[model samples]
Target chain A: MAKPLILVTNDDGITAPGVRTLIHIMKKIGDVIVVAPDSPQSGMGHAITLDSTLYAEKLTIDEESEGIVEYSCSGTPADCVKLALQELMERKPDICVSGINHGSNSSINVIYSGTMSAAIEAGIEGIPAIGFSLCDYKWEADFSQAKEYVQTIVEQALQHGIPKGTVLNVNIPKLTKDELKGIKVCRQARANWKEKFDKRKNPMGKDYYWLTGEFELLDQGEDTDEWALANGYISVVPTQFDLTAHHAVQELNSWNF
Target chain B: MAKPLILVTNDDGITAPGVRTLIHIMKKIGDVIVVAPDSPQSGMGHAITLDSTLYAEKLTIDEESEGIVEYSCSGTPADCVKLALQELMERKPDICVSGINHGSNSSINVIYSGTMSAAIEAGIEGIPAIGFSLCDYKWEADFSQAKEYVQTIVEQALQHGIPKGTVLNVNIPKLTKDELKGIKVCRQARANWKEKFDKRKNPMGKDYYWLTGEFELLDQGEDTDEWALANGYISVVPTQFDLTAHHAVQELNSWNF
Candidate 1:
């Protein structure tokens, strides 16, 4: 049987330590191909390059390791998936995974996440996909502690394919392997960031602002992704791309058009 | 009674004819504040700025339009709404309006629209929001035909608030006022764009690709955005920020943790 072909991409630039760790771990499981943003696309949600052109380049970072087929793209995470499947990859990947991102994409933040967008893009194309993120935001954040858990989850997901119209949003708590609790399959927590801007002036003495926010978790449920991460466990929330409000449809149906 | 404060934003940049038209319509109804992107964001989706600092400045294209606060943001449409609500606006806006976008953001494109993202951001803030789009894609697309319909809809929306957790995804047909029918409240049409990449070599002999697609409608029902737009009627699909597949939730609940 042919080894499972795995496609890996991330919102962080191709050289980020996070994707490097993902590439190493994925090699142990299957044939891995890396197609990722040329620059950081952290909050780029489901954006695709429609109005502009996209550039891609084949690159080699190391000769010591079994060379992973890699391409750095000048597009959003979703664009990378489209390019990989449409232009680069010779065969469709058996499994597509995004991230091992340096920050969490759980709950409401998922709606503004580039990491999850890649996973969603793959899922839209009928491929089983997963997006993994660590709660830490530091550039040199430790990803090794989450590696073993990631391998276990990816192996299981590939073995038992994900359900149609669904992709996994796997967020690992930033903790040592021994300190980490086992994985918990959970639902997305109802939460949103309370946005607060940091207002400042530029060198020209003109007013400018930086978008910053404080995370405010309104939901106190124990089954939420926030709760799981808080308790030092990995959370796997099954996310879907359809934005339809099925329940609201009934109410909307009653409205006079 | 205090006049309702209308916050206007769009992905097509501050100078797009679509947004200028929106600004005009909104100004007539209420005190309008325009917080929009500095450059066209088109398919930028729900992206936010995280890796780099954001810059927003008070903009004045004409002295005639005074006292109405306007800011040009250096981020995605989602970032614009977040900034507007957090820093620019003195108080919570009564309503948020995004777009009169140059191209269609109906159906599946809603998942990949920066215009709709602005509306969704406003919805998350518990503010009534709507994103308007024109079926035409030209830079000079005439939005005059949409004025009366848009004004009526906005007036109605302000009079009767949108249901909680919902925003309006409104797409108008590109037609003269005489040619257009009335508005149709509908559901998102099940549709997708079959992507085609034009791969080419640059002067440096490096490969680059342009993203293009032909939209394919899979739904034949008249109660859909595509159907409404095709029939020369304004389409309003009440959208929601909660992306949970509630039906799948039951099956997911049955899964072993």
Candidate 2:
């Protein structure tokens, strides 16, 4: 039997250690193809390059590595997935995976995440997809501790198949393999960033602002992603692209229009 | 009685006729504050300017207008809302209304809409919010026909607070007042773009591609936004930001992790 085709991409650019680790692990499971952004697109959300031209080029990242195809695109994470699926790939991929991102995308952060956006884009195209991230947000953060658990989740997803209209947002707690707890399928924690603008003046003496924020978790539910991460467990939240608030539709219908 | 404070914004820039129309109508309803992008930011999704500094300046678009203050920001639509709530507004706004957008944001397009993203951002910030869009994409699309309906919806929303964790996505068909059947509160239609990359060679001999698509509606449900629009009715879909697929959690839990 032919090995399952796996498409790999990330928001942290092609050379990031996080995605490099993800590619290495995916190679153990299937034929791997990597199409990712040429630069960091950390908070790009689901943005597509509509007003500009997109350029994608084949790149040989690791000369010694065999049976791996890679390309980098001048666009957002979502754009990379769209370009790959609609133009690059000859056959539909068995599964698409995005990230081992440098930071967490467990709760409200998912709304602004380029990593999850790529996975969600694949899900929109009816592909089984997962986005993996670590709790740490450092350039040199270790991804080794996540390798075994990442393999486990990917293997399980391949076996059982992801639910329709949904994709997995897997955020691993930054801990040693021995210190890590098991995986927990959870809901997104109700949380938000308490935004604070760090005001500063540019060289021209004009006031400018830098967006900084503190994550404020509003839910203490044990079944939430935040709670699971705090308890040393990896959190897998099944994220969906259907933004309709179905419960609110009935009430809205009562309004006089 | 103190009038409701309505925060107005759009992705079509501050000078666009769509937003100008929105401001004109909103001024009749409440104290209006406009915080919109300085230039067109269509298809920006939920992006925020993290790697760059943000600048906002007070602008005098209509100096003769009373009870209205406007500012233009060098950021995405979501960033404008964040700045308004965090830095600009003296108090929490009673409600936020985005767009009078020059195009549609129904169905799957909501995921890629800067107009809806602003409304969703305000919702995340615990404010009642709505985003209005016209089906016509032309710059000079007539917004006069939408005035009465826009007023009705805003008045209704102000009277009955929006549902928690949700915002309103309102799309108007490009029709005269007499031609519009009515308004319909409905679910987002299941649909997707059939993407086609128009590959071309640049002047410098580099291969580039332009992303284009055709909307393909997969659902024939009469209770969907698409149906409402097709029948000459305005469509209102209650949009939410919590992307968790709650129903899929149980099934995913059954997987071996």
For all predictions, the C-alpha RMSD in Å is 2.1, 1.0
Backbone clashes in candidate 2 total 0
Candidate 1: segments with Cα more than 4 A from true spot: A63-65, A253-257, B62-67, B250-257
Model 1, DockQ value?
Answer: 0.55
Quality of candidate 1's docking, in CAPRI categories? medium
- Best-performing candidate as measured by lDDT: 2
Best by DockQ: 2
Tens-digit lDDT track for model 2 on B99-170? 999999999999999999999999999999999999999999999998989999999999999999999999
Q: For residues B62-174, could you state the per-residue lDDT of candidate 1 as single tens digits?
A: 55456778999998899999988888889999999999899999998998998999999999988999999999999989999889888988888887788788898999988
A1-257 in candidate 1: lDDT tens per residue?
78899999999888888888898899999999999999999888898988678998888755533578999999999999999998999999999999889899888988988999999889888899999999999889999998888898888877767877889899988888899988777778887899877878889887767777789887898888889999989988888776766556565545444
lDDT tens per residue, model 2, A1-257:
78899999999999888999999999999999999999999999888898899999998777534568898999999999999999999998999999999999989999999999999999999999999999999999999988999998999999999999999999999899998989999999999999999999999998899999999999989999999999999999999998999999989988988
Chain A TM-score across all models, in listed order: 0.97, 0.98
In CAPRI terms, where does candidate 2 land?
A: high
